[model samples]
Target: MTADENWWNGSVTYQIYPRSFQDDTGNGYGDLKGIIRRLDHVAGLGVDAIWVSPFFTSPMADMGYDVADHRGVDPSFGTMADFEALVTRAHALGLKVIIDQVLSHSSDTHPFFLESRSSRQNSKADWYVWADAKPEGSPPNNWQSIFGGPAWTWDVRRRQYYYHQFLKEQPDLNFHNPEVQDWALDTLRFWLDKGVDGFRLDAVNHYVHDAGLRDNPPDFRDKTEPDYKTYEMQYPVHSKNQPENLAFMERVRALTDSYPARTLIGEIGESHYPVERLQEYTAPGRLHQAYHTALMHKPYGAAFFCKQIEAMFRDAYAGCPNWAFSSHDVPRHVSRWSDHAVTQDDFAKMTAALLLSLRGSICLYQGEELGLGQSALSYDQLVDPEGKTFWPDNPGRDGCRTPMPWEAQAPNAGFSSAADTWLPVLPPEAARAVDTQGDAESVLTFYKQMIGLRQDQPALRAGDLVFLDMSEPVLGFVRGGEILCLFNLGLTEAVIDTANVGDTLLSRFADVQDEQITLGGNGFLIARRLSE
Candidate 1:
């Protein structure tokens, strides 16, 4: 098959949260040059590509997720030349680069938004979603922001309320306007022309809201749940996730297809019928792949994995999934699932195996290979707006967004020369730094072996996934009818007969007898089928 056809079908991508990944200037923030210096380490991991979070020109209100200029590199990240060199270095190391594209909204300071809000009849007027308030000066609708409170912010310049799905500083663009659609496409072309392999489209569902200015109905599901987010109190069918996204995605796909081997992946933040939305967005002519937060949530069990995996493959029309255990926006899986493990390293190794063995593509967050857990930060040290807004009860994602620890005893864990980081580099994280985990039994070593095994065994990559019948705490599956994978995900030992399975190809904490296979807690086995 040609490389362009489906290079990401079962590929593995390493995600780099640029600000906390590596700092080269001793400025307490990571930049493009720091990432360039670390390219060799990423290439050594046997990953297919790297997906970087935003580094575009931004005010950092949302830490680069809010873009002020779509086409320019932020000075905090480095000059435009630094980005060009980064792409050059990544390609030389055999690593494809995928950058974050925040297309749904732009910073309020953006010139386009400034012009759009400037009197109703300016040349750039109608560039953003603008609506007049009610007679009593109330918001146009009951739609809420994901960050907090009302989704509408009043702007006196045009005597209208502008829409922001996230922070008020970020104004949603009017995709219903063809001109805005063209501008978004042009922003994407700006990067494709710079040699990027793909883009991780941010907030793909929030692109076009209902043009009718409808009020969202109350959501009955989450009102009873503890610590339920205020925004999710109402069903957002009309507020966002409009059917219009499907056609807009096709336009994005068409532009991406113009370049060789380019890809487009979308992030669906929908809570209602999420998997279906993921599939709808990634249909043949749209996004190449799309991911939802199903796996990233707190649910952990064989049944949960079985059901979620089955949902993705059951519908042939829904495009394939790219699975992740942790990311910049969520808590680290090790810390999140600590109840299931006897040791953090064992759980980390087991989760890594499970994620890699899945049917679709994989994305590994930085420091995952080293078994890094989420860092706990004091309220005073919080950097995430989400975390600060929701203190105590929900400490936000700052815990998971800590700096990458590269060395154990070196200054700031060899991540930066500065004494402090934008987010503190906690000691627990520094203890498991890459330098300290090179032992034969380290999680890092196991990750390399697992990634190599997946690359070596085609059945693990593109093979069809047929789940075997197993009860709770024990999961088994066959790939391409040749490779059988078994896992014991409990806190105690389990023994099962595996006489039908052939020689073991890989295992951890597993012992095989004549017919019975003994699996210790968090144990796993990958064997070739005897009949194959």
Candidate 2:
């Protein structure tokens, strides 16, 4: 790929939720040294880049998402020297390193927030989003958090309500404040200077809020949504996806422009504005790629995939969008879509192949290739505060945060030598251990081969998506006007009416033929366009 060309296209991004990836010191949590030790395993997966979740200094309230020190590593993860070694090792293994940047907020223990909350006259008083309580003391507005309940929290010292879109301990950063923006940008440069390749901007759109502090409008449409955020029935018009955030994104773009071949990807989430904001964030001088929750859920079927990819292509946003069937925030795809027509193993392999064949880039959450299902955690075993609050209604994301299984027989799945791990690894996942799945016919092996195909095939890499409309359960598209992709999301057999296109290049099951293509249940077809 050219220097200016986007490297993220068709690239496989491996997401390592550091806390659960591996534990080096047996401290009951995975750390930086553990990641460094496993760099070879990651590189062996044929992924183009590795995206490490936050390891920034924090109180562990939100598992390091609440940053106390932006430039330093948490003692639990490792020291700065260990981080440097990780970057060096990852790069040496031909893997790009992208760290998570939690620019949206910081822990209450953060110096800026501590000073900001002390009094209104402090040097950093405006560093966080703070507002006086209403006369009725109900709250600034009806902004419920994803974790549940009101997004605003009371502060006894300041006697004012402060904003936190997430956990109250994670106070929202005042991106509206010029100093705050400058400080965040400087922090970005600090890691860039450390030889980091890129950043996965956490809740990037949530950085800025409505200066007016107006209440979010009601939305009774999605009242059936299991969570409080959706049940509050409010459209977060002024609260998130603020018009002002785009200009700041341009500033971030300018800062990253100085670094050669570096990338910036934002995690765009807003109930009202999704794909449109994705386009705005990545249009030219903003983010290199923007990911949404479009293909991140739902069954691995034809209609859902077709509608999503086709919509992106029709909107012309497919060029810079990133797709993942599963991530840390959601249940594993194997478990989520296991209800569809196939076994868990088939669901996992099919999703992996489909993700690699998509027009845009892809992110592979850790252990996804092994067909790891969501870990079953009882209410008592749930360590995630988010999960605890929602209880049985909204189980939160604890299921996907379980430790990775490396061994089939070792206790704790060999994730840690420690007597216990942060989260238990289930027996089924243990059976799909890396050691057992390293062989040629294993699911892991298939992922390796498919990822290699994506990297090596130009048509799959920088391809323009061409929609091939078909009946339900059959999703079809052309990559680079050369590679034809078809997916059967339903149970029964499906046909690829290749009357216009010719012969199958690849098939999930069955052999290639000269003319039409027939696929069995949960089958897929890939073909090279005939010379025209």
Candidate 3:
């Protein structure tokens, strides 16, 4: 692979949710300056890139995902100067900086939305997705928002119901409008010129909507499950994942390609046709990568992993698929996959090893390396509005957004000097703090070793992945070249035939050569071919 292709092919990216990373100003919220202060810490993890969540000016309805300004930094996240400094610092450490770009919609406070809603004939009126209500005075259609209500919000000013795939305060942009397309593309240029390496495009699949204003069909599945029948649960067939979205993705791709060593990775949310859409969205000259959370919500087991990986390769992502086990929105992998049989730390460490051995690029959520289990947040202490709205039944993401534990003994776990942090700092997490795990044999050390191993073995990073035929509870795959990985998800030790195996390179437990190797429950092994 050329240097440019090498940039993303097998690279490990560290995702930093700025609000929970660190708070330098003591305002109880993390800022860019805090990120700059911790650049050395991130670089120490040996990751190739850093993906920061949005810090743009927003109404905070959905945090920074609902942007009001495309070019300016939010006061809560520090100034634009602070952002530039962060880019400079990260680049100096040989780390690529990828910022979150929410192109699907903007805060209602955005100037485009303000002017577009002012008059139906205004120059910017068509820049947003707007449509007249139904003859019966209902919404344009039955589109539902992800935040638990109708996707269409009635705007009396324009005498129409505009589309909002998320919170009503976040109005969807009209990518169908050519000028609007130009504006969003220009926003990419603005950042690349400012030294950003790439973008994590937020809700990229929802860029285009059904032009005919079609009503969504009802889903017959149970509506009481946590993520089942919420507002976003209604039929999203016409509201999102439209085929027309590809042309605009191509336009965005062309813009990113104009820059050297830059990339675009989209966030696609769809259960049906997700992998298919991934293939189309990234089919060569469109997006460099795209990710869906299908596997994140499933139970951790050999069968689940097999199906997800196979589908990805068999479908659209057969050519290129970035692998991520966890991110900001979903439950942390450790807690989500914890079997009462194993200690939380064991699950966490094993998960890190498993994610690193995947075929495509890897994204590591913050604090995952420390074997950090999810924090338990009480209803009153939750900060995420989503968690608040669905309380008890569907507790939001605040459990995963707790402050990063930096010290096992320090007050507030060394995350903040304030008497109380924005999110609760759990005592269990504090015990596994970075300071405590900096020791040579700590779980954090294991991550460093595994990540370094991936970096040293070019074959592990970008080579083709071939799944090995195995029995239940055993998942196996040979990364192109010489590396073969075997994972045992069973509760009892099982011996595997490695008659063709050569030398052991790394193992979570026991080691073996050409002989039969016994894998402990939840254990894994990695070996290189003899010729290598």
Candidate 4:
């Protein structure tokens, strides 16, 4: 494939949560100007692209995920000129820019939603997923928000209930309307015309609903749960992951194809059948890549890894998978899987190696290379609506969204000049700050070497994956029949046959003895095969 067609394949894309990455405005929040100043740091990591989270005009209800304007930047994140500068600087550093597109829903404050909800026969009455209440007037159906409670919220003006998959403030758009689809496509086209390399399409599966307003069936797997109180109590067959979504995917691909070399990555938000959904989205002529949380959970093992990988790659044309161990929404992998490792750093390094070695593209979250753990916050310090609403049971996403630490000795760890930040910069993250760990065999250094190594070896990059016969702790695989990759996720040292293992290209906490390879806790090895 030509560079234009295959440049995104197996590439490393760094994810930047713009709000917490760096603060240049001294307003206690990072903005596009900060990112412009930090472009060199991202390019230095040997990554191909940067996936910036939303910085659009918003009410901050669900952070920038609740976008009030699709085509404008929020003043807090700086003006359109700042965003243009950011894209220019990133491109100048050889880094492609991928901005987030929250097309599934819009902030209730958005003009579109405002006009739609004003009256029954407005110009855009069906612009949003608004429906009449049931005869009893409780809700339209038993559909529940992913966060919690009923997905439908009553609007007094329209005298109809609007569907919200997240916060009540984020109302779902009615993609069933062709005009809505055209509007969404225009949003994508605007950014593309402005030279954005790609988009991280948020909640891609939630674009359309069943339209029949059918109640979702109960999730009988866990019997004790009450219906409509939680998202997990029922299977979301009607609410999301609908069959019509595939048609929209093709439309998105059609638009993306119009702009050569621009890629579309869909975030499959459904709980059930995510892998299958990912496969469908990534099939020929669909998204360039699609990813779900198949590996981001708390579980740690070869068994889990094998299951997710096998299922994801079962179809030859399932398309490319974009793997990530941690993100702004999930707990830091190092912290989530810390108990299984002999040391925190070891686990972090292992995950870095594992993620880059997978047979698809990679998304490295900001601060992942620094071995940052999830920050623990007091209830009073919580800013996330989900964290505040769910409290002890589910702490929500605030911990992972904390500011990135740059200098250990600088005020606020050089994250901001303000007296305090939107989220406090904790000691653990500060200790592993970029300035503190200066090339002394650290996780940051390891990530650089590993990424470089992947670039040096073609098999490690665009090669097909073939899993080996291994059990439990030892997850072994070969790339393009030349690279032998082995990872021991458990504390117990496990041995794997090393007959075809040639030169030890890169290894950590591993021992090689003739025909046997012993991997220590969170150990890994990447090697090339002997000349045939």
Candidate 5:
């Protein structure tokens, strides 16, 4: 099992939202010790790596995303020793550890920001994105935060506005300053020296914004999305996905390349031209891989999926993609795509198989393996600021970020020893706890099986994809030139003639008889093509 220069090739990286993974201290909050306690569970899934979300020292403005100190672990999550232990234990289990690095922004409480805001003549005054307000005291530009407000926040001391692409507490860093870039690189070095295998760079596309401070063009697209945020009303051309980000990525890549087999996976959150940015950012000498929010947000269907995948491969031929159907920020895929499947469990298994069959690396969100659907939380139970702002109409991400259910009958579903959790665990999620499905022919087992198949099959792991002509509802593609992967995204049965398609390798809720394949509702199949 030797790895090449690109060890992440054809691998599965399980994403663990540290706050909800496990709470080992009975503090009602997940910590490093909890993740260490659950390493075996993750290893059992046969994933190649684990991507732990930020556990950095922070003010918790946006959970752990708003870091107050880049190099220190948050006291709530654990100390530096605990993080070291986690890395050591993960390495012992043959799992590479990829920690989330939120380089785009930091909490306003961060030391640099504090100093920068104190006075205009301070040494670090320009460390963060600061601009003067227009004559009318309006924001410098028409940029909007992803969290539904103006991107600029007024600061009394400096009498200037600081930009934040999220909550005002999270001030965006000024990549235009060479000193800031150097400092950011040094921060990456600190983690790399700590024996981390890689980093999932948060909001990599947002690293650089238009230096000229131009207004973003309006987004006139029809608003059909149920949970549409006001931020989506603008094109965000000048706010993010700037060309300067590519050079900065190259700098990031140069640093990671110095470490043996270390990788960098950038998260590109651009609503429009995300794939284009992903392709540019992940090209050779840039980040090793790039993941966009397309899969997590798009409507479920063969056509939509096929179009996304094909566009990614076509545009980013030289780059690698890290595909994921769910994450801490988005609703769980099983629930998000519920209308497209027959049953939750059935859809989970089918999507698992389909995700594993795709080319490039994959990221399995923490609870997806247990077929966990979104936990419906009330407005009062919501902790995500985005959810709170759009409550009733748009429930926030707390539903997806709820604690991981470990025990079906235990207190707080065994997520915490405390009577209450940060977010309530709904009964539906508790019922599908890991203990109940550990041995059964459940979604967890199916994920393990599919992942094992991916690990054993070279074609499925590192294959070049070639789409086959198939009608609506059925997606057919050849991987590595020999493996035929087909999926039925419709609710009804779909049949495809397999007169020339080869040996059946794996099937989920589907059957093949007399050279014809019949995929039941939400079914899928993977086969090896017959050699000429």
Candidate 6:
């Protein structure tokens, strides 16, 4: 609120996946005007900032992740004026605005890629990652795409194969070229000059790849769990997470540091050493914060979380962490971990408290406050190529990318007035619409309470965490040597002796009495020590 240099520390960031947030144009898709109209809802949540996912000009391959124009907004998402209006309104409500910056790759349809692939002798010929085919006409290497199939796609125009970590429609940029780095930095400068607050760097680790064409090593881990693509079979040692990524990050940081209060939070996807990569990428002279997918992909439980968090902080990275349980790429946390939760609503509230109590910046995906479970979509309803590719085996991300339900009884659940939405809204999500639970004791209200508590308690926000020795199903930790946080991440109720505990600060389905506390299934509590 004070515009401090470290304003992001312990801040609550709300992510709005533009396509599903709101549809103001009656065109069955969300736009910037719709986001401006909904800014009040985000501000009401007591969030410190809002991180809007990619709304840039794209071919819609991999959704907006395949950017066609770095500085232009997609016609489907409104014009630049509309974006500026949204930023103005958000700042008026004392909320910082962060937009997604996808620098790792661009749509193959982009002019740069088009020019690069023209004849291999053009000015932009080296702008993209192109390589000669093997003697047998196979790909340059054995790299695989994250969506599926080979990472390399043969181009007849240039008579060469280009590398793409995702879909073939997306061509990886050759960051080894200095001009490309400068071009990307200029794109960030364009947004910063527009008075934007910060950027969430998409797939930051994928910005650079092994300079030498090399095959990745196989991951010999158990394959009992369902993996959507063969990409997971390999460790991606040569395909991405290259050592040169740190130098590029330093360049990005240098540009961002030129602006006051402008921050950079990088998204580190599934890497061999995500935690270590995050730490290195966010260290001094690099990214201000790095978001790792470890927590998002981890098994749900106290032990798993404790181990992950301990490992992350043990190394002590200079840059802070930006944590989130749900985002556009993954399934909703409530539904993902439903096997361990007694009820979806209870689990949602419990997770909200747990996330805010953690020692780092937090991100809340839109519709999460309403306890929206993943929408069950049929094969035909799926738009995500990844979802269609893995059908029954993986289900892809379409389930979590559905529209947000505003009015339960309204047409299309108030997301749009059109006959159909991009993705179907399930009955469960409609039943938990915003209007239906505004005045009730719902997950939305619980989020507001938890967020307010975090804003008021410094210990809960930027405190040092010390795990407490508690029995199974009861995970306890002390923050800043004062705030004691406890959770029962199981189906059965659990009780813990609270001899050192003091006055209750915030709680959900939990009570303390006679130096003891009883937590219901999927319950949580935050207490402050009297001695402190």
All candidates' TM-scores? 0.98, 0.96, 0.95, 0.97, 0.97, 0.98
TM-score of decoy 5 = 0.97
lDDT of 2 at 25: 94
The per-prediction CA RMSD against the true structure, in angstroms, equals: 1.4, 1.9, 2.2, 1.7, 1.6, 1.3
Better of 1 and 2 by lDDT: 1
Per-residue lDDT, model 1, residue 95, is: 84
* Model 3: residue 516 alpha-carbon error in angstroms: 1.4
Give the CA lDDT, 0 to 100, for residue 4 in model 2.
45
TM-score of 4: 0.97
lDDT tens string, model 3, 415-514? 7777767787888888889999877778899898899889988888888788888887788888885788888776677788766676677786655645
Candidate 1: which stretches are off by over 4 Å? 1-4, 222-227
Q: Relative to the unseen true structure, what is the C-alpha lDDT of residue 480 in candidate 3, on a scale of 0 to 100?
A: 82
Instruction: Give the winner by TM-score: 1 or 3.
Output: 1
**Candidate scoring better on lDDT of 2 and 6:** 6
Error of 6 at 323 (Å): 1.0
Candidate 1 lDDT, 232-269, residue by residue in tens = 78889897788888889989999999988888878988
Report the alpha-carbon TM-score of model 6 versus the true structure: 0.98
How does model 3 fare in lDDT?
0.82
Pick by lDDT: 2 or 5, better one:
5
Instruction: Kindly give the number of clashing pairs for every candidate.
Output: 0, 2, 1, 0, 1, 0
Specify the poorest-scoring 10-residue window by lDDT in model 3.
223-232
Residue 430's lDDT within candidate 6 is 91
How many residue-pair clashes does candidate 1 contain? 0
Specify the poorest-scoring 10-residue window by lDDT in model 1: 220-229
lDDT, residue 381, model 4: 90
